[model samples]
Target: MEDPRTDGAGSARREPEAAAWGERVARFVRGRVFPRESVLDGGGPEAAEALAALRAEARAEGLWALPLPAALGGGGLSFGAYAELAEAEGASDHGPAALGSAPLLDVTMLARFGRPEVREAYLKRLVAGEVRTCYAMTEPGVPGTDPFRTATRAERHPDGGWLVTGRKWFTSGAAGADLVTVMARTSGAAGDREGLSLLLVPTGSAGFRVVRELPVLGAPGQYEIALDGVRVPADHLLGEPGEALAIAGERLQLGRTLRCLRWLGQAQRAFDLMCERAATHDGSRGPLADQQLVQAHVFDALLALRTTRPLVREAVALIASGRDARTEVGLAKVAAARMLQQVADSAIQIHGAAGLGPDTPLPALFRTGRAARILDGPDELHITAVARRVLRTYGRAG
Candidate 1:
């Protein structure tokens, strides 16, 4: 059979050069990077050193960040071209970070609206992986998808600074983050979207505290933060006081697209795992591959993956072309997230007890799949958004 790494809706549609670049990234991940999973996860000093060395190696091989501009220390791939490369890089959770491209969101946003001082201080460092940043938007009470419900507040100080006060949770990578882009109300009340602002709060501030780490699936990944009058310079404001929502929308569109690509890669990984199990695991009668029931699992996973792939690419392409892609992104978000969750479930079922343990990557991939549905935005939110958009089309016709 052909190598599954180069097989997909996105890969088939990609130009030869683009597809080859993506394939090279996949091969690098599968070979040089996959073996260093332990060092990446160790979260220790030694692991840090090893990961830094690995990033240097990956960069030297022209496999670094592919989505950002080349002027910003990236591979200069457009969103359309980066879609397939993202899939290859998504084969492992550490693939993007290890390759020096994980800060795409922050770097892109900084380049667009950041103050000169702020950009000088953090932008290059972020691209170089010298610092880590987290986005704090969800609070203790608001729905994660509703920016209007944010309870965080920022009060302007007399000295051209602001005192931010609020509590945020599920702030991913906050434990070690050097900075956080906090969304807080500067002029409007709760449930008002127009007054929200994004403030670049340095983690060393007196009141910017890391309350605790919130573990998902029994592992610590996200964090809770308490901003008790955290002071930030006036220039820390991103874009403008009332413009964060629009900026956030742009960032989220790109983020969701990247996630879809990553999820596709992960689903493909699970699909391969299921196929391997079916081919090798012999039961009472014969190899699982010979049994119709096992074949059903493989077929279903492939179907889900193949179907979701095109929808995701459609969304990515729309976003790439600067078109209004809310409907497409909503559809892709719900489908790709569900696809990953379902494929991971099937792969787990095929592996039985072995899939539950750490001996395989299935367990971790399953956790990511589950989170994919709820993170960024939940499936329910996207489903409603997509349905409403479709209904609007019918309304217009009628």
Candidate 2:
């Protein structure tokens, strides 16, 4: 097979095959697995047998971990290609989450800075779906947009380990996570970006505890974690102290790009649902599709999907091409979130009261829709970053 990483842009490559495989994977999940999404409706263990069977099948069919490094037992798709595949997976809630295929910031840390043993221990398990991990950076009372304001403290331990103490909320998937990639201040560094480090803490470790699951407006569950003297060996530290911000910033850009792709899938799904509802509903004299208001909403949803998809695709391509697209990714993140919100809202409006009820899928989609504005750093933060980049790149009359 041709190496996707080495192929030149716009050159004839194996992307078609990769996209075909992604479609197959998406179809398999949609046909066989989505019906079981009800398992995750309430706080409950996913249908273990079905889930395990799907994982095994995915692994056998070379569709396991698309985002991890290929040498580490993952599909060797590039970021651009992976973004396309991610859109398909993101169309349904269970697909991306269950596959453990979303963009993982900690994976970048482990790949770039971890020791060989650390990679073998953590990355392998994560890629194989044997464990789930969460990145804990945001504190409960602190504004998550400003990392310099974090209050979590990690003190050196006498036994060659570290003691981590803090409270974290809005942690995605932390409830069932096997480990947490925690960010804490280790030194008395003057700047927020300094004196910080990333540590790996096991879930049931000495002082690691989950306080409660937070209920999002539309999603199933998130978790609040309290680390009261959680201890881990010194080897748990990822990268050197005071390098957390740089590492996290780089990782966050990649995360935002991935999120844009996922939300594209979500927006497309909503658009499709809206169209289907419009075509079939007969509350008006004509089909909803025949109504000018309904047509206008559908047109707006299509435009949003079209506009955001290319921006996200371009951002992913730029990042994959070894360019730093912190600004572009930020702008794309904001646009994608807004577009998805608009699409979801239109879907609900087209469906009328039925959309709000449990019988239709729009309510569930609305829950996911509402979080687009906040997840992976909110719109305000990204907008600020975009402005800063704009000023630095094109300052007044320089």
Candidate 3:
């Protein structure tokens, strides 16, 4: 477990300091997070208490917010170094939040584009984990694949502010968020790409409401929300007007890459479970590991994990250097997601009835595996996008 250091050329190398930090994270995930999955996932006062205790422990152990800036009260790890530990940190669903890395994307976005007022109001608290935030970009009826078609609108008010109105669903962590970064049309029509903008909206606003929880595969977190003419102060806008798509694209590049790493971690966890079961669980003939079919499952899962890791790492290197990583990120996103799903399925199959039951983590892994394809951007979208980008190069040569 080494922290991956990047050279001047943005290539990954090994570093002892980073390795020690990465090991601390892996140990924390295994020692603390893994043991409390039931309580953390339970969703009640007890779950809240458990999570708070974990966060406090994480802070006490000096393992909190490793990827955020040192000026912002974090460990100040570069994205390159953090990418090495992300897989370990993200092995459990609660890892990022507990370790205070969950807010990296939003915190970074706000630090870069937030108005003085917005930053002064929330940035410190967000990094300190005093408050939580969620991003709202997906609309209820609009296809999330096309941001140009966003239906949410933010109209200019007489006072030079905004009146936002929209319905958004599948907004993760909205139920507990203190603030939300919403994507809305500021000028152009629904199909126009130029008018989308980012607005910072507090959940306590006059017209803000959480409609309901939209659980995925019986797991909680996602929510539907409504904004009925919510008044947002003029300075609440992120970056310039009509810059939401650009901001979101930058956010997603990192977001999707981190997600791919986490998916690989979870897939590796599932693969381990599958192997352990195969080696120990007796079958009709003998040990399941001896069976060719079970061996094939092991081989395939390992191969997927092995191949997807390098693609994800390559994307990480490109992003860490502030290069255009759209193609690399797109390829890694699809590959890692599919790898997770395939590996998790094989794990579940090896486990038989117990895998589907609540006794094992296999069920939860499988649930996330299924949803991974659709989240961020669906597999089909990534496939077409990557193919289009690749084809354009050949087109230019011709």
* Tens-digit lDDT track of model 2 for 130-160: 7788888888878788788778889999988
lDDT of each: 0.83, 0.77, 0.89
For model 1, state the Cα shift of residue 115 in Å. 2.5
TM-scores for every candidate against the unseen true structure: 0.93, 0.92, 0.95
lDDT tens digits, residue span 1-398, model 1: 11111222332333447878888899988887778876676677876787788888888887776555554565666667778688888988888888777888888788777888888888767877788998998888778878898888999999989999999999988878899999899997898758988999999999888899888876566899999998999999999878889888888988888899999998898889888988888888988789887888888888999999999989987876678888888888889888998999999998889989877789878888998989889999988888888888776443
**Residue 49, model 2: Cα distance from true site in angstroms:** 4.4
Report the lDDT tens digits of candidate 3 across residue range 207-273. 9999999989899999999999999999999999988888899999989998998998899899999
RMSD (CA, Å), candidate 1 to true, equals 5.3
Model 3: residue 264 alpha-carbon error in angstroms: 1.1
Off by over 4 Å in 2: 1-16, 46-50, 189-192
Model 1 backbone overlap count:
0
Q: Tell me the lDDT of model 2 at 270.
A: 85
Ranking by lDDT: 3, 1, 2
Model 2 worst lDDT run, 10 consecutive residues: 1-10
Q: List the residue pairs that clash in candidate 2.
A: 218-367
Candidate 3 Cα errors over 4 Å, as ranges? 1-16, 396-398
